[model samples]
Target: MKWIRKIAGMQSSILGINERNLGFIYPNNARKNYKYADDKYLTKNILHSHQIACPLTYAMIDAIGKIEQAWQATCEWNELVIKPSKGAGGKGIMILKKKNDQWFSQSKPVSEQDIFTHIANIIFGIYSFGDSDVALIEEYIRPHDIFYQIFPEGVPDIRVILLKGVPLMGMLRMPTSRSDGKANLHQGGLGIGIDMKTGRLKEAYDGEKHITCHPDTKHPITGLTLPHWDEIIRMSLKAAMKFPLHYLGVDLVIDQRKGPMVMELNVRPGLGIQLANREGLKDAIYRAKQENLLN
Candidate 1:
């Protein structure tokens, strides 16, 4: 009931309320990277500065001046992840796996020339909002085999929603046929509720209501307790404290060997979290407030 009211309150614009709720809310202008909630480059910078756990970034080429060198730099790590710094919703990301001194992508193999061209396009910002975008070459995480067993050839991540530096609610995002290998809820993936107190997964929702099997893999989506759930929640809260924003959604992936790594921070997290939990995020927010999270 609380979640329903919270979800309903958030959509006040549709509720025919002409009067603004300005006092109870802060305007969105003060938030950094508001337009791009999950900018990979900005997320890395925030994580790195705070010394939070994240995938190591090898190189970041933010301007045309550093583009050529970024291309020529032979990555020490054979397998790497290249993605637009400002990209979100799982677009413009490429994973390069090394085999026998040659580079192979998730879908295709590439040569040195191919890598250079790709970097060039990144410098040109072909895959981003504008020509001013940057490209990040980061450590590629071999996701834990347990999750991979469910969604092989894809990375499954957990999304933790934080309100005022407190872990409020969470969901495990699993890739599905509709998402094309992405675990984003809107992209046809599945969202499974995480018990806030126990950190165990409770149920699964497909951006709407309860669902058991993945639409693509046909795999069951419930009853799997996340590894390092408490640690992950602690890390999410700690990471949020480092940022200036009051409300955010932090995504993380657990690597087989690397543990937990921050994926991205979303300033304007989607309302899908409500449906995923089968409860409103508003109730969690109120609970956190009662615990003095605003302080």
Candidate 2:
């Protein structure tokens, strides 16, 4: 079956932020329920309790005094991902790998002091929207082998926007040299469209123009279908049902071994996905409404 009901011959209606906030976010999701999607640690708690697929959290620090304790607990791992609990837009996220007794981030050596400083900044709300935030130290996720063809390294994430627990639209965000290995469109990465029914990738959009292949690797990326498409959908639906929020933007990554792991959720997912898919959220919502599928 098609992921969305067909609306033939009609033009796709672009969804703007104002409309998104008013139409879907405000009506479907209440302000008090935002924490289900806003806080990374809280989101993971739901995932963990439900036994859903996600990266294992090594440690979390919410106070300056707990910094050393949290770091010491998770520092034994050769690799770790540090991020703000309430961060948005991929901010305050760092990956540290141990190489020959030295910790490194993005292939550059970082001192033990550097790791501690980053975590302190996270707790102080440096990368968060609030004045203070929790720091999450999680096991680093290794991207699926299929992504190596798209980029030499870096994990690309799949963003699935859902309404009323049903999948609406999807996009594959991949990293590039300019994005510093971060797969966010606004950070100079590429947003590749996804075929909802086929799970195959469409063209790549670099926040400006659409292309068919990776700009740096020159590898043909379009038409390659991602594995475990059905499981990915079910995994998303499980998380959505666990939360009180009706509107969600669920971010996930395909781990080389774990298949699909939920990364985080957003009550207010961006509208740039429209450009990535060359389709519109307005159009998808309208179609879902007509089919009585959003119930």
Candidate 3:
């Protein structure tokens, strides 16, 4: 907990998960907004209505019977992402890349039956928080060259915490061989803190150790400025305003061609973001409150 004190500086500013949920998310986020952030299909629709750029939805399957037709419809797409519409923690996400009529999942060839069963399980709610869920197939994002030079295998995304439509803090989550090509911290990815004003990497941590370079790529991670920095900030704020929730965690991905696109929105965003930024949320939280921005 020493790092907690170092980040918070004062005991009063320290916020625990329970406190955060009760004080911020519970009070600020409405129930209706939860559906928009929880369900991928609903999220896409909302973003579409707001004219916010996001990964294009290729297809959606809500029943097991439609799995075959859905798969067939996506045959023309050489690269696609299949995910549970209401998934959490990056679970139930399958990335498929086509090669000469063969489909592969993370370099391992997967049969058509394999893809079918996975989608079936998703519809049955195996990854949808124990409720019936829909499967979303969307265009796969080819990460920008700047990120590819760091870790070329997986898609890296930036998580920005916004309060009352104002950008607060941000972190760049990079995928490693350990995270199995997913930019999820609990899955063994790296969390690199970013300067809120500049969108430049400042500090990085690989879950346990402070790092200046990526553990696997061995590439220096700090001091590099992200392209479309200002747009990313503006996009995040715009996305927040579209939702009823005042507190939000907006995920953005920089595609090689599409530029910055909204990946997802979280009403109850994880606390790992605080660790990633190497700072406490209390200062920003209190500042927003004092400025009447939380209203």
Candidate 4:
């Protein structure tokens, strides 16, 4: 609420999608490098090639026949995340946590048949960009204690915007009960803006309301500092450099044991990130270009 009053006085620096496309996306991103960032499987392979840490892939199912094999291989693990390799906005991601020998998705018990149907839809491009996609079953990361304190139900991830290997802005996304335990802002999750310099919480927004505390957890979201702040930025920048793109959005998650690992890379990252930071991205973009950082 306090930030809302301050927002009026502050000159808006929001970067519109048109400007983003003309100024950053089209000029910076290349068609050749899109595959590495757009496809989750390829992203993992590329990250592994560069020795960058990411969620471990247990198995990949490209067809219906492979689904049974992949599921059997993953059965040994108590928890696993199965998702469309080319999915966007958290669509078709099933997180299975085993309890008392039963698998559950979002705490609801799911049968092997249900999972198979989901994977079938993924292979049919139901969750992808109208193209056939593979299903990637990966190790589910358990976030650190700090994230648990903020929101105990779902995984929280940080999105850092980078320009030519420099981190310009960042935000932390926490899932709410309404989001069905998915850390996506469009799906009722909380977006807390992070100060890029210190990785400290600067502001919080939930799509509709701007607040200081989480609506569900009632935990204060401001002034909280992310663990391994510097490492997060470093890892984001490192991942960005691996791509040929001049601008990128690197999503990083903090594993309880691993510290920081890249979850995904976005060549055309959403502009909603500016809303979380309470700052305009246009200024940062102009600055980067003027400094020749875009080169």
Stretches off by above 4 angstroms in model 3 are: 1-12, 286-295
lDDT of 4 by residue, 175-197 (tens): 99999888988788888899877
Ranking by lDDT: 3, 4, 2, 1
User: What is the lDDT of every predicted structure here?
Assistant: 0.72, 0.86, 0.87, 0.87
lDDT of 1: 0.72
lDDT of model 3 at residue 55? Answer: 99
Summarize candidate 1's per-residue lDDT along 1-295 as a digit string, tens digits.
3333444655432211112123222443254445435567776777888888998888888776776677568465778988888776777777888887778876678987777677667667777755556788888888887677677866888888775567877888887757767777767777788887877777777655587666666666577677887788888888777766666788899999978888888775666666678666556666777887754
Off by over 4 Å in 1: 1-29, 32-39, 63-68, 207-209, 289-295
- CA error at residue 223 for candidate 1, angstroms: 1.2
lDDT for residue 287 in candidate 1, whole number 0-100: 71
Ten-residue segment with the worst summed lDDT in candidate 2? 1-10
* Candidate 1 vs. true structure, TM-score: 0.82
What's the C-alpha lDDT at position 8 in model 2?
A: 27
Clashing pairs in 1: 3-280
Give the poorly placed runs of model 4, Cα more than 4 Å off: 1-12, 286-295
Model 1 residue 226 lDDT? Answer: 79
Model 2 C-alpha lDDT per residue in residues 16-75, reported as the tens digit of each score: 667778888999998998988898899999999999989999988989999988788889
